[model samples]
Target: MTTRVRDDTWVWALAGLALGLFGLGFVVRWQCTRGACALGRHEWLFDLDAVGSLPRLFTTSLFLAATVVAVRVAARSAGRRRLWWAAIAVVGVGLVFAKLVSAHSVVEGLDGRGLTLLVGTVATVVGLPVLARLGRAWGVPGARAVVLSLAVYAVAALGLDQVTGLAAGLDPSPLPDAAATFVEELGEALAALGVLAVVVRRLPHPAER
Candidate 1:
């Protein structure tokens, strides 16, 4: 019971932290958009679209941490369980690189919508079933929650973002560009943090192992 409580505490704490960080970015963005705050030289720190912004860094760090935890878990696992964690770790690493390099721009540069659709379709058709089988074999706690979080992240960051861009090109978008960017970036960061929390919860303490 105590261990369960502790695990729940960690999950809630990480969720709060993710929201708090997003709130801070939103406030800064609102102030800057209103010409109320003098961003001066540190504007990048508050700009959600910037590559090395605070939000981006936090998100990248979360992915890296998740990867580390997955690697550790894999090291102690065997057979299909090890493969499951190893696959998750690889995905985490890809996410970290994607965040750091702003991979969306590259995707957009190359037939954006088409590429996204193709990749999303392939992932849904191929990746989901494979991962589902591995997940059932491993029986990792909180796997469903983590997958749901990733789904939300993909919708906000990939789907909505492209739609927003297309709308902006066609006419004056109902959703303000800044607001859309803020939501996309915040969704991604929160999702990454969620994945990290679940992975951490499943990783046993050194003493336990």
Candidate 2:
């Protein structure tokens, strides 16, 4: 990772995107909530009609563009194999659906939770095999590091709510909900970058091994 950061331009791009999301999403969140209560994004957007769609549309566009670039790179080297093509369709649809969800917005009630869980489960099922292959394309050390970074990202993005809910049920302490929210947003950016990194890391393909 260290050497790749210096040698590869994509690494720099990924790093920049990660930092940009952290600065934009995380910093605003901290300012609004002061690292205290969770500010539900859909609720906030529900009231503030003017400023909500701008950021989500903008960020989603950027992420989709990055995904296209990664897919292009992979296709160039590996060709459009089954996993490659299927992964693209799955992730592309997922991102589009995510964007639609953001634009339409959903109240985080029981219905919303069920919807979100369903979407998340489907995405996880489709994405895991592709992501696993990408991680292992790197050798053991690089693969391990990439997978770990992605794990941090996954936990922060996907499982944080469940973990926090359990914690709250067990002990109603002041959960840094604000902080967790920012981490979740930041993790999305980082996770996307991690996928890009795996693609353009200049490592040998699995077949080469």
Candidate 3:
């Protein structure tokens, strides 16, 4: 008999992680300003200031979550084993505690074109092998879509702000700080959800337990 786990296990796990992280960011923002949250002044306290780096935090966490998911799904489909997930559990638990401390850390956005290029290029190179392995099994069913979605996500989540900054720096058409934050955070959330969707789609499903 093939060992099987419910698809809902990972589905719920990833969903919860994303929502919980997003909420934690909000809580930190709220507490930082004691809930003042005025339009002009509160923006910095939220995520634009040097009070914690949501972009780095979420992007790293979510990317790690994806790695966990991919490794888990691959293991499940390839073998009847589940022990590999324990590694992810360790990091996830540690991160839960780290969030509180991160509240006081400097706010860092996905700035720096050089950093962006390096991260994107490295992720693509590392991911190519994994995707190829999946292709051998899933046979391009949804792999291409996942790649496209994640590419769009990376650009939207990590690159938009840099572009806005460059434009503003060059021509002095600066966007309101609040508006910029909103756009950046929105991109982060959307990209996160998109990646989760792709991961969920790739997980192997059994018709019945």
- Best by lDDT, which number? 1
lDDT of 2 by residue, 33-139 (tens): 44442555543441211234433444455446545654554454433343443354355556556654652235335464446556665656665655667646632
Clashes, model 1: 0
lDDT of all the models against the reference? 0.72, 0.48, 0.51
Can you give the lDDT of residue 185 in candidate 3?
55
Off by over 4 Å in 2: 1-6, 9-17, 33-62, 70-83, 96-100, 103-115, 130-156, 163-175, 202-209
For model 1, the local distance difference test gives 0.72
Q: CA lDDT of 32 in candidate 3?
A: 46
Candidate 1 residue lDDT tens string, 1-209: 23644436766676677677767777777677666668776867967767888878878888899899989988877677777878888888888898899886677678866786677657655865577666876785556665655566666566666765765576543336566666777777776777787777677666654
Residue-pair clashes per candidate? 0, 0, 1
Q: Which candidate number has the best TM-score?
A: 1
Worst 10 residues of 1 by lDDT: 1-10
Q: Residues 42-161, candidate 3: write the lDDT tens digits.
A: 454336323345544555466566666766564655332233233323433443343434321212334445565565557655764465455545454456666666666656745765
The order of the candidates by TM-score, greatest first, is 1, 2, 3
TM-score of each: 0.79, 0.53, 0.50
